[model samples]
Target: MAVINNDSSVFQRIPNELANSIFDFLPNRDIKNLRLICRYLDRHVPLRFNRVFISANPLDVKVFLAIANHDTFRKQVKELIWDATLQSPRSCGNDSDDDYGSDEDSSDDNDYQGQSRFQRGCREAIEDAESRLVDKADGNEQQSLLDNLMTSGRALSYYERLVEEQADVLETRADEEAV
Candidate 1:
């Protein structure tokens, strides 16, 4: 039988640095499980799983948001993997003839009956993530991951060139428009 007690000896046996390293590679779900194991472990897991890779699926976003809502250690995610070529639906109408399934109409009150539930969950998650970021920023002197990426020399130069080209294009367009 395993006993749960606050004998520092239990955790002291494992080195803190090693524990953090182990925690770093864990998937979000596993990380949450490990956190529930003990308070000492909880202290080490950062809020919002800071250095995460979001892919094409919105489900990843949903799960991350779900976890980030409750975690105190996660920071405001600095890098978002934006799909440059994401496709949007051309029409919102429900197609009953489709083979798989049909979507409910946006105007249907029954379809939106659970909307408040979804909204509440999303709101709570954002608020929690915001709080964690504010707390972390207060103590850290280093630039956030987002700031560093935006201001780096290569990125900065690229944007500057792009802006100059845009300005020239805009000036030419204005001349044409005047004519």
Candidate 2:
């Protein structure tokens, strides 16, 4: 049997329709790894890892802000997952002035109730501190801080705007096809 050597590249020989069909069957992690194999794959693989989880924790907020500011990454993002659970520091159970109950008469149930109340208080304190920091910040910083606070609604709005923009692009492409 004679060896067949096609002048065209393997990827070029495969139709984009077939490539997309194959890509659909692959898991997201595999797809991401496949994208690194060649420029064509890199460009053709639509963003499957689209969800961006943003928690109330400061570090996660920082990451969310970074993604929001990035033009290309932000457009690829489809969902903004918000986790609003407050992350409080572990208490030592020492008799500090901030302690909710006196150590003398605190039973197990009362201790649990007190801890719950303390957690709520901690959450409120964090919000108050953040507000104070925002107030002290200069014009741009203040705006950024406010944006971080409103990120849940703002992220949704941003995603909606992106969808609208994509729709417009599709419409323009369709018009070109018609012509």
Candidate 3:
């Protein structure tokens, strides 16, 4: 019969390679929290999160910039997954066109049209609020906001071009990898 000592840490018992293998299965948030636990974990956890997500949000961009500025953290980054649709729910304003239905009942048609118009109004209101916020921002704040916006726009454009050129090959590779 084999006896195991409970006094010593389980992590200490496990080999470093095995520990790293386990860490690879953890979510990014869990790995980040684990990094805060100890110096050893801090050294390893950042490397596990190689792919960083940069969204259209200002805070996400700031986080990306911080990571980029750090020498150790920057070296750990392997890929950046940019989410351009973070700000708006729908990428385009074609929801109204999709809502059109061939209904004989006038009331039903009226209701559909009313709902479509309401959605459009809501979208416009959001855009207006965003523009107002930008306009009311101070010089430095406005410039920062503009910089973030430009960065997001550039990323989106780059992604679009990549998709246009290599979408089929990328999709096939992704599908093959998934299988």
Tens-digit lDDT track for model 1 on 1-179?
34333546366577779876776677888777756766665665653545544333344454545544655534555554433333232233542233322223333212122223233333344446556677465535432532333322344356456555545534555322321
Clashes (backbone N, CA, C under 3 Å), per candidate, total 5, 0, 0
Q: Can you give the TM-score per candidate against the true fold? A: 0.30, 0.37, 0.36
The collision pairs in model 3 are: none
Residue 8's lDDT in candidate 2:
45
What are the per-residue Cα lDDT tens digits for candidate 2 across 43-162? 667656478876434445556666778777778778877664443433556524554544334332111223343434444554576668754646676556544453233433564565
Q: Using TM-score as the measure, what is the rank order of every candidate, best first? A: 2, 3, 1
Score each candidate by Cα lDDT.
Answer: 0.46, 0.54, 0.53
| Candidate 1 residue pairs in clash (backbone atoms < 3 Å) | 46-73, 46-74, 47-73, 47-74, 48-74
Off by over 4 Å in 3: 1-8, 29-44, 86-179
- Model 1 TM-score is 0.30
Best by TM-score: 2
> Which has the better lDDT: candidate 1, or candidate 2?
2
- Model 2 scores worst on lDDT over the 10 consecutive residues at 106-115
Better of 2 and 3 by lDDT: 2
lDDT comparing candidate 1 with the true structure: 0.46
Error of 3 at 57 (Å): 2.4
Per-residue lDDT tens digits for candidate 3, residues 1-179, read: 22333335356678988997898788888777765665556654565448777654444555777787888888888898865452222245644565544323333111222334333453445446567776464666655654344232344455555454344434444322321
